[model samples]
Target: MSGHLDYEINKELGECYLFMGELDKAEQYYTKAASSNGVHADPYLGLAAIAIHRGELEGALNMYQKAHKVDPTDKTHAGIALVLMEQGRGADAFGHFVEALKVNPENMVALFSLVRLGHELNRLDEVVPHLSRYLEIDPGKSEVRYSLAGCLVCLERKDEARAELNRVLEGNPDFEPAKELLAQL
Candidate 1:
């Protein structure tokens, strides 16, 4: 088989092992994949996941950086942002999450994390636009809409919050959180 083909096979095996929670086997296949193609990013991303599973935050960050250097995909940016969040670097993570969203606006993980970090760090203004964008994409996601409502409440936009909460309640009448929030308004 060609080197690229070998890399693909090994990378697939690595992903399977990772999904099965066999970190050692996953690392071995990922290493083989990396050896097959020194420039491929997928193997490095797999390795980064293994490092994270092992609680080696620094190693995971390094591996994520290597993957980003090879190919700056939304997944790589999200991975880097997750590591940064684990390290309590919320501001840095926020930027990376934003970049990830820019690459793929429908990235749910980045969207949720950005909203969460924004709340934790009191950067609610930065979060509103993203939340609005997410709501535009997935209007039926009542939980997310409820979160947006909470953010609007924090910003003292009571009317907007009420509208969002109403939307959430309309979608899922049994959503107690939205109902409670609406009651507050």
Candidate 2:
């Protein structure tokens, strides 16, 4: 059998196990794939996901960083930031999230992290701009609209907040959070 075929089979097995919630078996197959000289970062990414699911934030970060080194894509940066955030290193998480956004502005995970962290840090002003960016990229995402509305309300922009909340209700009239926010306004 070709080395390429072995690598592919191992990586796919790893992903399958990971998605099935078998982290240890998933890691074993991922390690096999990574050791098989595969060209892609799929095995490493799978290992990182397993580490994350098992609450090994530092291990996840290291695996994600290694995957990034292998692939150097925007997703790798976002994955690293997610692990950092899980470890409660918000400032460091923010930086990696920014890097992911710089590489791919449409990276939703990175954008969402920035908005959530900004709100947590009492930087409500930052939330609007990031939310605006997300809305521009995915205008039909009602969740982003709701978040934007919440941030606007926090910043004392009642009219704008109300408008966005109305937009959210237009999509999902039964959305309790949107209804609750609207009632507040």
Model 2, which residues run further than 4 Å from truth?
102-108
Show the colliding residue pairs in model 1.
Answer: none
Poorly placed runs, candidate 1 (over 4 Å): none
User: What is candidate 2's CA lDDT for residue 98?
Assistant: 76
Q: What is the C-alpha lDDT of each candidate?
A: 0.92, 0.85
For candidate 2, report its TM-score: 0.85
Q: What is the TM-score of each candidate against the true structure?
A: 0.95, 0.85
Model 2 per-residue lDDT tens digits across residues 1-185: 98999998999999898889988888899998999955678887898888878788888888998898888887898998888788788878887887788788778788788888887778778557767876788887888899899889988999999999998898888889999999989
Give the winner by TM-score: 1
lDDT of 2 at 175: 86
Candidate 1's displacement at residue 119, Å, is: 1.3
Ten-residue region with minimum lDDT total, candidate 1: 33-42
Candidate 1 lDDT, 57-83, residue by residue in tens: 999999999999999999999999999
lDDT for predicted candidate 2 compared with the true structure: 0.85
Q: What TM-score quantifies how close candidate 1 is to the native fold?
A: 0.95
